[model samples]
Target: MIKVLIVDDSALIRSLLKEIISKEPDMMVVGTAPDAYAARDMVNRFTPDVITLDIEMPKVDGITFLDKLMKARPTPVLMISTLTAKGADATLKCLELGAIDYIEKPKIGVTEGIEAYRQIILEKVRTAAVSKVARRTSTPATVKQQSIISGTEKIIAVGASTGGTEAIKAFLLALPANAPAVVITQHMPPGFTRSFAERLNNLCKVNVSEAKGGERLLPGYVYIAPGDIHLGIEKSGADYRTVLIDGDRVSGHKPSVDVLFQTVSKTAGKNAIGIIMTGMGKDGAAGLYDMRQSGAYTIAQDESSCVVFGMPGEAIKLGAAMTVCHLDNIAKTVFDYLNVTGSGSRL
Candidate 1:
């Protein structure tokens, strides 16, 4: 059976979680805590397979508590967050600190909708239980300054979901502006992708923006796929550009990573590098396989460093990845690959 711990300040919330989880034959709520202090105690005693953590609490907030837990014990954690803008931001931070996934709190009179949340929670917990956990330490100076190649018109394609927001940040912040042009597909709600891109742009040296139709793929700039459409890469004579394809969902995601990776394989071919980060599904595995078959180098985040190892693990199992890397090493690995090949022109 999968053991779980629920850490929330609300008694009602805790009770509801227990009720929901108890219905599953293979899962059980082994412990409950009102705050991080109690959570630590439960961790020592219960040794749960999963933790459902709340963002707001007295004495210790969820983000701080999660950081401590990951540094110490490193179990999978799912966040319970309020459905406000502030809550979304805080939950994003939690994902960065290594929480596996999150469920939004149900609104008043919308309790029936919570069944979906319960299902998502249960599914994430089960998936998290079997995933590999990589040991994470502070970024080393050598990794921060690593470069791929001196002068290549390089392109990096990244795909992520679930716990990707923070994973992307951790990887990108370590990248230099001169690295390459980058295209990213992160599973997100509408309006949030732009905000996320803008936030990353401000924090990192490279330019980051939400992709628009026909935008040129320029060095030192990162284009994020819009939430509701598929973003593809196209080559026009000597220049590569973004193409937004508005269509039905592919693999249950609008901007599916498979679609993006397939496009990159066709357009950039051996000149590109594909990085599949942490996420909860198999969206990118087939496309990543295509990229590898086309001679583009590919890397998958290792199970230990992933929020959910589903996507990368699938890719690795399928022989799509050339290397399985930890989150802190991913940026440096990209640079190292590029440096050996010189750049796009050389390739």
Candidate 2:
């Protein structure tokens, strides 16, 4: 059985979480704490398999506590955040600090909202329980000089989920500022995407920002699909532009990687490079295959480097990927492809 620890200042939220977790036959609530100090004590006593952390609390904020917890005793943590931009930013910070995943708290009808999202909450907990807990010690993606923009006219398409935040970060950080025009879809909620893009922009040499429809895709810039929207690319004269559409969930997610990949296959064709990274489903497999058929170079993150080898594994199994490499090497691989003329294999 999965043992869980709930750490929140709200007694109501704690009680509600306990109720939901207890109902799962394969899970049990080991303990609950109202603050970081109490949560630390409970950690020693219960040794839970998973933890649900609230972003705001008295005496200590969730981010600081999470930093300490990961350094002292790394464990899988699922953040409980409000559905506001601030909450979204903090949740992203927690993920960067080593939290496994997060669940957004509702702005209204707390009890009913929790009940409505019970299945998702439970599923996230289960995913977290099996997730890796490594302290990320990579230096920040800080560059002093303006990155030299390569004049190569190529389009880069990336998709990720679950542990994609860090994977995406690593990929983007390694990229030279003027590498290529990049479009990405990372599974996330609506309010969170903007903050995530902003965070990446501050760190990476590339100009990363949330995509707004109709912007011309340009080299050195990365367009991240906004939450609750599907992002696609279309040819405009000699250039391509970003497209955001509202639609039903495809492959069980909004801003799906499949949507972006399929569009890239049709629009950019041979000029595009598709990379599917760590995620939890087959959302991008067929699209990646379509890309390969269109003569675009396709790459998948290797199993050893994936936080969860689900999405990329699916793509490789479908023969969608022409090359498979570790996350650390993806940026270099893309550069290698751009540097070579044609008919090249994995780097």
Candidate 3:
């Protein structure tokens, strides 16, 4: 059975979570904590396989508690947050600090909505139970930063889901402005991807935006696949362009990593670099395999740094990835492989 610890300050919320989780035959609420202090204590006692953490609580907030928990005893943590803008930002921060996933709390006067949220919460919990929990590692403070490539251009296609929001952010923030033309497919809702793209644009040095059909692929710009559509890269003579395909969902996702990777493999061929980041399910594995077979460099985030190793793990098992890297090192690894001075460079 999958064991869980529920941490929230609200008594009603805690009771509601308990009721929802208890209904699952293969999962159980092993413990409940009102605040971070109680949570820390319970961690030592129950040793749960996963945790459902609230972003807001008395004494210590969720983000702070998450950082502490990851530092002390890293485990899969699913954040429970409100649907407000502020809540979204906080929940995103939690993902950065190693939270596996998050679910928005139901709003007041939405009794039926709360029930729906309960189902989502349970599903997220079950998913988290099977995900990989990254352990905290200490790095030297004086580690030298690597230099960016002076002049090089290549196509970089990235796909992710579940814990991808923060994983992609962390990976992209390490990239230089002149890195490459990046096409990203992150599983997100309609309005959410736009907000996520805007957030990435603000956080990273590159120009990040939602991908539009037939747009010219340009360097220093990142195109995120819009929700409910498949993003593909099309070739035009010597230049490559973006193509958004509207079709049935592949592998249970619209903007599937498989679809994006397959298109990149066919269009860009050996000129592309495919990256599969942290996520649940096997959406990108087969496509990443195809990318590798087509001579495009493929990389998968290692199990040690993934919230859900399902995608990358599947790719690794299929021998699709040339190298498996930790989340913190994935960007550098990609840069190293694509650097103009390096042997793997196509430009």
Candidate 4:
């Protein structure tokens, strides 16, 4: 059975979480603690496989405790935080610090929302239990934009989930400001994606922003899909523009990777590149295959570089990925493919 420890400052949250988690047959609640000291002792005693951590703890903040825990124990952690802007920023930082995933606590109907989201919370914990937890690593300095042939004919359609925030950052960080127009759909909430895009814009040479739809896909610019909407592309004469599709969840996710890839397949055909990064489940496997069939080059992150290889692994098995490589080499590989195919000028 998967062992879990609940660390929260609120008794209501702790009790609610314990009740929800204990209902799962494959996982069990080992213990619950209201503070860092109590949590530290429980962690040593139980050595739980997964931890549900609350960010707004008193005395010792969740981030500081997380940093220490990751360094000393390296156990898989799932953060429970509010979904406000401040919470989004802290949760993103926690992901960078090696927390596998997070769940947003409700702002208004605390009991109702938490109870309603029990399945999702349990799923995150399950993903965390099986996920690989690594100690903190230093961030790479942003690479400067180098001049390359400028045009928007070629588009890059990227999709990721789970560990995607950092993977997308690494991929975009390595690209020059003059790289091809790129679009991404990461499985995240509305507020979080805006923050994620802003963070990338500050660090990378490329201009990154949340998609407003109808804007021309321009070279040196990146667009991120807003949460709760599907982001697709449409051909506008010789150029492509972003379009947001309002619909129910596809592939069990709003802003599904498959929706984006399918649009790229039909609109850009051989002129596009499809990248399926680290995420859980098969959200993008079939869509990646569709892109390949449409003559778009497709790539997947190799298992060694993926925190959870479910998505890419499924794609690899289905022959959707034309090339598989480590996360560190994806940008180089994309450039190499483009250069050989004469799609764009290289640096």
Count of backbone collisions within predicted model 4: 0
Question: By TM-score, how accurate is candidate 3?
Answer: 0.80
RMSD of 1: 3.4
Stretches of candidate 3 exceeding 4 Å from the true structure:
9-13, 33-45, 58-60, 71-73, 106-123, 130-132, 135-153, 236-238, 339-347
Residue-wise lDDT of candidate 3 within 72-149, one digit each (tens)?
A: 888899898776657766776787678888877655455867766776787788888887664434431221235544
- Give lDDT tens digits, candidate 2, residues 1-347: 99999999999889878988999999999999999999999998999999999999999989999999998889999999887888888899999999988887634354555555998898889888877764595754433223233443478999999899989998888877666789999999987999999999998889999999999888789999999999999888877899997999899989899999999999989989999998887899999999999999999999888877889999999999999997877877787777673333111
In candidate 3, the residue pairs with backbone N, CA or C atoms under 3 Å apart (3 or more residues apart, or in different chains) clash, namely none
lDDT of 4 by residue, 172-198 (tens): 988887888999999999789998899
| Pairs in clash, predicted candidate 1 | 133-304, 134-304, 148-335, 148-339, 149-339, 152-343
lDDT by residue (tens digit), candidate 1, 1-347? 99999999988888888888989999999999999999999999999999989899999999999999988899888888875657767876776666777776545346776877778778877877875443444643334434344333467999998778877888778877665789999988666677788788988888899999788787678899987899889988787889999988997788999999999999989888999998888999999999999989999999877867889989999999999998888988887776677533432
- TM-score, prediction 4: 0.94
Q: Which candidate achieves the best lDDT against the true structure?
A: 4
- Look at candidate 2 and give me any clashing residue pairs: none
Better of 1 and 4 by lDDT: 4
Task: Judging by TM-score against the true structure, name the best candidate.
Answer: 4
